[model samples]
Target: MLSRRRFLKTAAASTLCLTAAPAILRAKNLNSRLQIAGIGCDGKGWSDIQEMSTHGMTDLVAFCDVDLARTEMVHSLSPSAPIFQDYRELFAKQGDKIDAVTISTPDHMHAIIAIEAMQRGKHVYCQKPLTHSVREARQLSNLATKSGVITRMGNQIHSHAVYRNAAKALQTGMIGKVKQVQSWCQSTGHGKSGFIDRPKTNAPIPKSLNWDLWLGVAPERPYGLQDVYHPFGWRDWQDFGNGALGDFGCHILDPVYTGLKITAAPISISAKSTGMNDEVWPAQMTVHYVLPGNDFTTDGNLEITWMDGGLRPSLQGTHIPPGTALPSSGSLVIGETGTLVIPHYAPHVLYPSPDAKANVEKFVAEPSLNHYHGWVDGCLSGQQPSDGFDYGGRLTEAVLLGNIAVRFPGQKLEWNADQLKVTNLEAANKWLSRDYRSGWKLPETV
Candidate 1:
């Protein structure tokens, strides 16, 4: 076993090598294995850790989770890997031992953890949307560029054959230049916890969980119950999550951005909701965005509409064969030649039988790549993958901007991406970033 002093020296040298050149050359190391840590040890985090472990070049080094009880699964996988309830402690003790981290924490903590990791020269594979706010997304993108570290967001479908094929089809102009798009999901914004407001009763925090750490960055609130705020229920809260648009937009709109090559942020945004209160997101909503057109677009700008809570676009003008139904969650792209339907994580379909058949014959499918292993490979080789923070931050910025629109229903908010603010509404600018609690504030510098 390598001594602590020698490990630190070697890790520092490896990190320097990674920053000095492109990742095509492998990092200097004891072996080919890339040391990795897993934060948030259950739910999506467990799956992420499990998949990454399958990569022969990756080695699990440590684990961290706010809830200790939820960490049994990971502990069972790597008995010798020490577990910590706080990520900061994990970094303090094992920073030199880790080469990369897989962050699958709640939405609010993603930016805070990812930024710190990158600043320390650690590669990151974070879950999407990359951050809770637009400003955080932009900050992450800028930091990733300056730090020169491998980074990838955990929208795994981006590597799947269906989405890869869809992106290629759109780029190849299989349906001609895109005119408009309609994307939606059947999920509601505030039902995960089955409460629209904070529960009147305060339940005792679990003995194995660190309540304070679980509420990191988010405003302090009473622990409602087991399924209220922790263990997959935070998605329904405004303080910790971004609601349906934030949950599904990064996923369903991924092909739209990839295929159309949309790098610029939306110019304007507006929204309407069924109803809402200060406590949680609205149950249903629709958001509209106007963005600058790229090479794959037909006109000056492309309009995209997003809906959730079972709301969908009217298929009146679409080329669908009259009585066909749209997917429960997916996107419909209207192009000059015909229409394309991209179902979430499923095969994409083209409208008009003749056009569909002709396009299908010419289309060659792209093979699915292992998203987890791809990040592991990138870390060892110093090569950043396609969904890295640079791309994910831009994609996440657009997704989170829709949430800002949700706050001001029926009002159009003009955006200036360069300024990272809403030009028309001064009040709306505050939503671009959030106020972190004391002691949990993000570093002002990279």
Candidate 2:
């Protein structure tokens, strides 16, 4: 047998050779770029492209949209990239050429597109409030696990270092046991009332828009100037979108969920809304969710309240400093010992006292990272994404349940997590999963 020193030298040399060999080979393989495709090339989808391309190794292979004008516009920007009207055709024609897909369609189409892409073994980056309904969220989450494809939901707040650091602080008990969280969004309604009764007219579909395909997976309805392309304001409609809560809840409330790790379904959900009748979207709303308390203590409750459309709670005498503009969208966490305040769409600052200057130095600033780059890195490395389907599904469920509450405001909604059903109201249960139009069924994975 070889001496101990001689054997150790041989093993170390072999390890070094093996590690260096991969680096040498990777240098030769530098030509390989991640070929990515974008569906729904307007609105946030354009932003997704800009972010993904920042990594310098991603080639925008294709752009797909029902609107020809949007696809043309994206094609103009990426002259070398191919364009397609139907996403299915685009995938079929270029599946081998593409490495990943980013979906930024309306809520109703999120599950169908994302599920199909994942089934094809493609990594996915889907926009926030992950799905149109609670069932879709759960379905997508399970499918992501089964497919073994890297996935991320578009709750970009998780990518913010401040959000992560704040979560870490909360987890490490910096703020004591968090008992309550208040999250809100203040925005005007889409003002769809006056246009509701307009009679259907047989206007020619614009050359730039494939009107028939734009209404994918949704009920067939006549196309109108207000309905398609340009403004792309279908988000206010119940059939196509989940309204404001579904739009912003994922971004605003995501930090709280990240910090608390509150994965179990809400024990109860209740909503208070204005102008319930003759309204597809609530003029203003407030939703309350009851969650399990901190693990360190027993017999405690954590309440998360959501306010929107200029409807905010009484924050009088709170730790939020005077003269600081109260954020239109953000979270406030109330712990037993103190409070933590995060401003809307900005980095959070710890509030140790009501005075602006107290304990100012203890506040640690967090770095901001590109959310799209995080997903791309995870896709290439096989690591789990920061805001993966598991976290996103739970977040979507909480927000979509708020939509359910708005349908029948003031009624206490009982949720059965295991069964994934609303136990109290049968009429409300119907809204949990919608009927898909023919040829648009969301793919089911075994």
Candidate 3:
């Protein structure tokens, strides 16, 4: 078996030649199955693995997770596949056999694992937000382009009929030239872990868990009781996850980005929050983004407002009728002619009742494609999907930038995307990326 250092060196060398052709093209049979591995094998990870397994052209060869107790489901699905506590071990041992990897690990570990896998010419299907840091998102996208491999972000709803239709409607001028957008989710930033601060008492680590492995890139901290920092609780912490905006922004803002063709980075970002501490995110926050306008948007910078923690956009200007209620989580596209309300996972609605309703049928609704199967198909055919890292990275960058704005509540930080710098606040720029723990440091990127 290769040592971790040697594995990285080998992977780096392979990346140099990988740009010439995709790894999938090496299969003698063009129709041969893809040998796959699951880096995280429970919760959303299990669902992703289960769905990909049903694709018929993908085979699970290995499983890796920090906690052995949480891997029961993946083991039952692939009884013969070997399981490893550390993802590096699986990569080092089965590097040659694995054709692709599904990274359902916490937001913190996503970039490191995906970068290593892609460097080895392995396709990656990583969960959103694509990386914990904006810099990581940009670097990961650059590497994905350089490596020439199939890639997809695990924002599964991107394939849903509702979002597809919403995006199509905007492009088709159903709501002529969107003037502004308001998007929000009900999820809070720090409530999932049920703690506003780190636990004062340290609990003994479970034998089934590798606490060191679980902490991956974040600074070292003691393992607390169940649900404190393990399993599903990391979403509340600053180090391990991206809080509410990081968690749901990609899903909620996907259609807006797709519809507006927002390729340029936001020119400025300002935010306000209930409050925040060093360890956890605020419970409620609001961010404003000014992005360059496109053909789908009105001239001048297009404004987007984001809110969370039960904050909903006002319907006064949306023309949705005064008594009509908004969805708990969704976006409203304010346009010159009409407003489109897109509920998360539900059908979209248009305002100005009768007239807009008539045009709904004129807008084509795309058929919902199986997201997992789409990634597998992309791997086999070497055709990059619509939500590949290129698009995902840009979306994730904007989402994470909103989180950075959360730190300085009322300041409007001027963003220079080319330099990845916050021109107005040098201190804010520091939050763009983080200092990785000593042993988990990744190679420097441009």
Candidate lDDT values, in order: 0.84, 0.73, 0.86
How do the residues 173-252 of candidate 1 rate in per-residue lDDT, one tens digit apiece?
88888899999999999878888998888888876667778888888888887787888779989999988888889999
Give per-model TM-scores.
0.92, 0.86, 0.92
lDDT of 2 by residue, 1-446 (tens): 22346334323332111111010001011226677899988778878877888897788888877665555446655677766667776766676688789998878889988877877778889998899989999998888887777889987868887677777666666556676788888763334332333236656676556665677778877776645323456766677777678788988887788888777889889998775543257767889988777672225777889988876655654565556666677788876555677656676666554333334456465688888998888777778777888888889999999998887878988888789988888788887888987666666565
Residue-pair clashes per candidate:
2, 0, 0
Q: How high a TM-score does candidate 2 get?
A: 0.86
Supply candidate 1's per-residue lDDT for 131: 95
lDDT of 3: 0.86
Worst 10 residues of 3 by lDDT: 13-22
What's the residue-level lDDT of 112 in candidate 3?
84
Tens digit of lDDT per residue, candidate 3, span 104-193?
A: 999999988888787777899999999999999999999888778899999999999999988988888887888899999999998798
